[model samples]
Target: MAHHFSPIKFDNKGNIRESVFSILRNAILDKKLEPGQRLVERNIAEQLGISRTPVREAIHKLELERLVTHIPRKGVVVTGFTKADIIEILVIRTSLEALICSIAASKIRPRELDRLELLAKQISDEHGKGNLKKSNQLNNKFHEIIYKTAESPRLYDFLNTLHEYITKFTEVAYSKPGRSEEVWLEHNEIIAALRNRDSLGAESAAKRHTENSSKAFLEMAF
Candidate 1:
């Protein structure tokens, strides 16, 4: 393998298999490992300075996640997101995000609303300064605050399953011209509804925001 994978650092508190899996998963999501590229367990283990068993286990986990696939003659290969996959994920996100925001509108505390306002302002400032990466991070924190305020652990866990894809899609969407500013405006709308404890209003705003995000991603990606 020509691509050099950073060696795995074994922290006392972390599981080896999980660490390996995370590293590989991030590489794939970040497009460092392109679609259809073959993965050799021995080479990866050697490059990461780890045992083959952990590498094998990590690949298996990735396969189960549909991030990689086992080919009869080609061994394991990266399975990058297809356009249909992206659409499906974004569609699901729109529904779930709207539901979460609706729940949060009713359940959110004053302190959480204050925090959301702070994050929203920071996100807008960063985007205005053309620091899109920072803006994206703050945007994530904005939604994270809402998710926490909703106090729905099961829903949060379900969303976590789509985390990687959502991250990728949002990053792409932010790269589109004018999208960041629109995102800032959309955030404000959601926050306004939350401040008033308007569940229906929050749901509508959240749905609009995600729908716009989906459109931006589609326009930019394909």
Candidate 2:
């Protein structure tokens, strides 16, 4: 674990436990902490230069989130997402993203639409150039604009909880052959529907995009 995490420099402003929880959670999500890797509280506390209490609290939170599990003999171990977990998350994402696009069709302003068009073009260009990291960043921004334009704070917060998992799965999906190009076309369909204020069209396009993404991830990841 020492190789995976650096020592934390605690600032006075934030809760130590939350920070530890975030660090450990991200490690699991990012695959730095591989599945089945044991999370020893004392070792983590020593590595982070924090007291055992905070590390214990962080591990408890991770357990609650299902990112880790307490094995009787092995102690706390990382529990990375299983196939069923991925399916569940993607299924939920499909519905939420479709709803967002539908709401955005009515609410998106001209300037935001313009920005989305630019992002779509940039993502396509980046993909053509084989710059996947940059394209993925632009892709995230493209969706962010639509959701923000929808102006539903509660919905936004709900999606926010799944953001990291979505990002991770999307990265895998993009690695599939022709997946990037397919996503660009899907994005344009979404943009066109939004521009026309066609809620049903936008919703249908968004649903198709997410469903395709889920297919790509399952094909590539499994």
Clash totals in order:
0, 0
Minimum summed lDDT over a 10-residue window in model 2 is located at: 1-10
Which lDDT tens digits does candidate 2 get at residues 65-116?
A: 6889998977988898788887998999999999999999999999999999
* Clashes by residue pair, model 2: none
lDDT of 1 by residue, 1-222 (tens): 446797876662268887888788888878889999998999999988888998999999899878899889778999976778778889999999999999999899989888988998898889888888898888788888898889999999878777767877888898898986798789889999999999999999999999999999899989
Error of 2 at 85 (Å): 1.0
- Candidate 2, after superposition: displacement of residue 177 in Å? 1.7
Top-lDDT structure, candidate number? 2
Question: Model 1, which residues run further than 4 Å from truth?
Answer: 10-15
Q: Where does model 2 exceed 4 Å of error? A: 1-3, 9-19, 49-58, 72-74
